[model samples]
Target: MARIASEALIERLAEWGVDTVFGLPGDGINGIMEGLRRHRDRVRFVLVHHEEAAAFMAAGYAKATGRIGVCLATSGPGGIHLLNGLYDAKLDHVPVLAITGMQETSVLGTGYQQEVHLDRLFADVAEYNMMITNPAQLPSLVDLAIRTAYARRGVAHLTLPNDLQVAAADADPYEHVAPARPPQTAPVYLQPPGIPRQEDIEWAADVLNKAERPAILVGQGALHARQEVLAVAETLGAPVVKTLPGKAVLPDDSPYTTGGIGLLGTRPSEELMEETDVLFMVGTNFPYSKFLPEPGKARVVQFEADPVRAGARIATDVPVVCDAKEGLAALLPLLTPRDDSAHLAKYQKMMAKWRSDMRSLENPDRDPIAPQYAISVVDDLATDDAILTCDSGTIATWAARHWTIRGAREFYLSGTLASMANGLPYAIAMQHAYPDRQVIAYVGDGGFAMLMAEFLTAVQHRLPIKVIVNNNNSLGQILWEQMVLGYPEHGVRFAAPEADFSAWARSCGGFGAKVSKAVDVAPAVREALQHDGPALVDVDVNPNEPPMPGKVSYDQAKSFAQAFLKGQPHRAAIASTLFKDRIQRLGD
Candidate 1:
């Protein structure tokens, strides 16, 4: 009846407010699974079909909730499978704790079964990585790992050997050490928000006041400071441009706000960046520097929580290192509000026209459903508070351009890492966290097919997630990338006999539907959304459609044309659509 090390670990995590853990069970982790079984009331284990999906789910959970997410896996391959998703968490700077099983301590260096030196493997991905050799080390190690993940806002990893996991909690060589440290059992609270100095705020305000035209660029870091962002934008009469992960920072329908920036951004945003004299970047290290104001052309004022990341992306005239909400709030009062509406009015007009142009592309009657139209339908029908997740690829373009983040709606994707197949897993985690809310996954055929098995996890858990697969039957993003880069399209198309994802969903006891015609897009999406259980809608979007960039350069256009001249395999099908799209945009 003696407590085990695994039980102590679980109990400690529960005290830190972790109610769920995402992972799969394997013999290598049997002791940990047993611990979970014993502590079932305190923490529930979410069984995933793949360790990769488990990691993705953990990262997703952390991204949505702003809390530490935990995932577990068995030794060797199971532990290895968590690398990609853990990297996603690391690069995105989200707190996640990854626990992996390992071989018995005695057989670790002997190359025993499932012994892959997990701590070493996870070294690069984890900010704090360690393997627990002694059972007595469990409590302090757990506390440190959890605290490190919180402090760094990155992944923390721990590998526990099978034998030690079940070791008696009383086994303690370190208990006798001087200044006996006890395990921290209280719930962890975030440290106080860092605040910028009055001098720095005054300097940033001075720079902003002198500029004729100021534009605000926000990333995910600004999500918690929505009101502060709005106040600053309103005071400066500036256009607000959001990064992909920062989509929910402000209402997309706000006249002062331009949807997103970079290749997947809006024309208004591009125009604002091009013309603005001052760039006020808030809580975002937007990576696409080319889309920003020309290096020396605009003075940059950035507010970043981490001093190391301050001014890391663009050249800054003033770097305000502090929490975004606090920094912006402090800076707001010092600024002389701009009364001129010309700068803000220009982008608002452009944004209105840009929206109209987008609507023109979403033709409901177009045969062979346009991906834009399909996603737009889902957008129009989604709940105001719905949490939407998207995968990497052309589907991202569609979602970025079409989906309007308004009301209490939230959006997430693999922004920094830009990994594929994260949409479904993110949606699953969001649904698990908010079972009563509407959760949707907008994924491309290529990304969805990578980890489609996770759908069964949804079915098993009875999570009512609606999945909208843009079935283009090809790697749409890569195909267009090749064409735009002047390379002949090759290796982008999937082999013949495309998958019937809807059928697969049905097989897994979930609602399934397919929409092949434009007219069916809305109805099919509605049916899927209304399903009482998990649902998948496989919409056959036009493969010839192009996910055009915000502003295509002359070289890119010429390169695309060159690809067609070089006998790009679907050039005929794509050329007509491209021509039509160009003609429509030219008029705008």
Candidate 2:
């Protein structure tokens, strides 16, 4: 065992329960790469083609497993490449640690090759950012970086100079900051911070109890507080509307759950939202302030673990700053169950109708195969414990609307940032994190092609990740949005040259299935799931399908109509789908 600083750093990482790191090879990171070689058994390095994918993989791991995800890259361009995914983790409030290799210690600031101000570059995204200038600082700095990421639930960064990485270790002055082994806790929260004050919880409970038509809106922050959310919903007989990021918090099928509440939401949620007298917003900063209760009309009670985000969006009459689960536990007993079940019953009826309408959309007998049909088929074939990831596009809409999250099924959403090319890397990381669990990435053709090469990474690792690609040959979301905005989709309308995606998967030593028929979707997904390693199911879907927003404004209608008058291609298909959806919205 050589006493190199890189080995010490790697050892410290291993102590922090990091068994894997996603990164790529580079000259700047040779020392760290050598360290990885030295400690090959304990901490395996997953080689990725691009640094961005590595960063995304790390974020996905953190989101999926509720642990600090680790990614590595070299200085300059390599370090800069990580910002997108790091921002994803930061905005989503997932714990992630990014380590980058720097130029030699000798070159301070001489504009060296591949040189960039890495510390200042990462300052905005990282809660804890540091440069390991000396061997002595490595141990404490690394510990703090990891701890800060976990404690703050955001990105943490450290830059290791190429010289110091291979340099001899400093004497063991302080005891190791991390634990000798991973904690044996069933479900671990890195740093469980605050508990809600008794008086605060009581006040929150009282407000909801007195209100006649209280509505609950939950988000990603309240993921672990499902039972508490249900309890509150049951107590007040309120309809629960989930934010897009909180799609998996409660099963979409739950009578209390009114699906999503904005553009990618159900009409029932929006209708119930306007009708509610009180808005109990728990563990969410749902960005669409327009969809929320009016400032004066509805009393807003927001419960959040992060105090910084309290009242960040809509005005909060009562801001309860605490962990959602803990706050709800304290508040649940204080509230008396509501006698009037009119609001809840009304929303339930609306939801039932919405479900039926959605079912019709999914089962639509379209020629090119409706996207919803394929999505719903995949959803049906999904295992109870499957971990799902949706790319940022129309596929996300499909997942948000159609996916059934029952039992242990969960979704990893690239929330807030809404970046493309995230699904494959995300699914890869999840599969790597929990090899035994079933992992699937619901990606659009555009997004899938963006990081399609990562499929090889999964194959090389034998991860058994199933990727269901909506091969629409177009950026459907953008095209639809362009039409909605009264602009002809110019740059985005063209499809890529013909390429065999499933065949490529098979060529890469993985299972491959290409489905063009609606009937083949379920069978394709089932086969993909049963494959030994990575399996890609490329399902050709209709390109003209549009994601019907929950409520279409007059301006939106005007713009869309103008676009239609201007002769947008496949106008009939989109118009027909819109007609059916609008009829359902009108309660036809």
Question: How does each model score on TM-score?
Answer: 0.98, 0.94
Model 2 ranges with Cα > 4 A deviation: 171-192, 576-588
Worst 10 residues of 1 by lDDT: 176-185
Write the residue-wise lDDT of candidate 1 on 233-279 in tens digits. 89989899999999999988897798889999988888889888999
Q: How many residue pairs clash (N, CA or C atoms closer than 3 angstroms) in each of the candidate models, in the order given?
A: 0, 0
Tens-place lDDT per residue, model 2, 1-588, is: 668888878877887888889998788889999888999999989999888999999999999888889999988899999989899999999989999989997896888999887888999999999988777776667778888888888999999889888888763435455323333342233567568888888888778888988889999888898888898889889889998878778987888999998888989888878888899998898887988877788998999888888888988888989988888888888889888888789889988888887887776456678888888887888788889998998988888888888988898878899999999999999988888898999998888888889998888887899988988888888998898889766677555574468998999899998888887778888888888889999988877778878767899889988998888877887777766555644653
Q: Candidate 2 clashing pairs?
A: none
Can you tell me which runs of candidate 1 are displaced by over 4 Å? 173-180, 183-185, 583-588
* lDDT for position 304 in model 2: 84
Estimate candidate 1's RMSD in Å.
1.5
Candidate 2 has a TM-score of: 0.94
Give each model's whole-structure lDDT.
0.89, 0.85
> Model 2, residue 164: what's the lDDT?
86
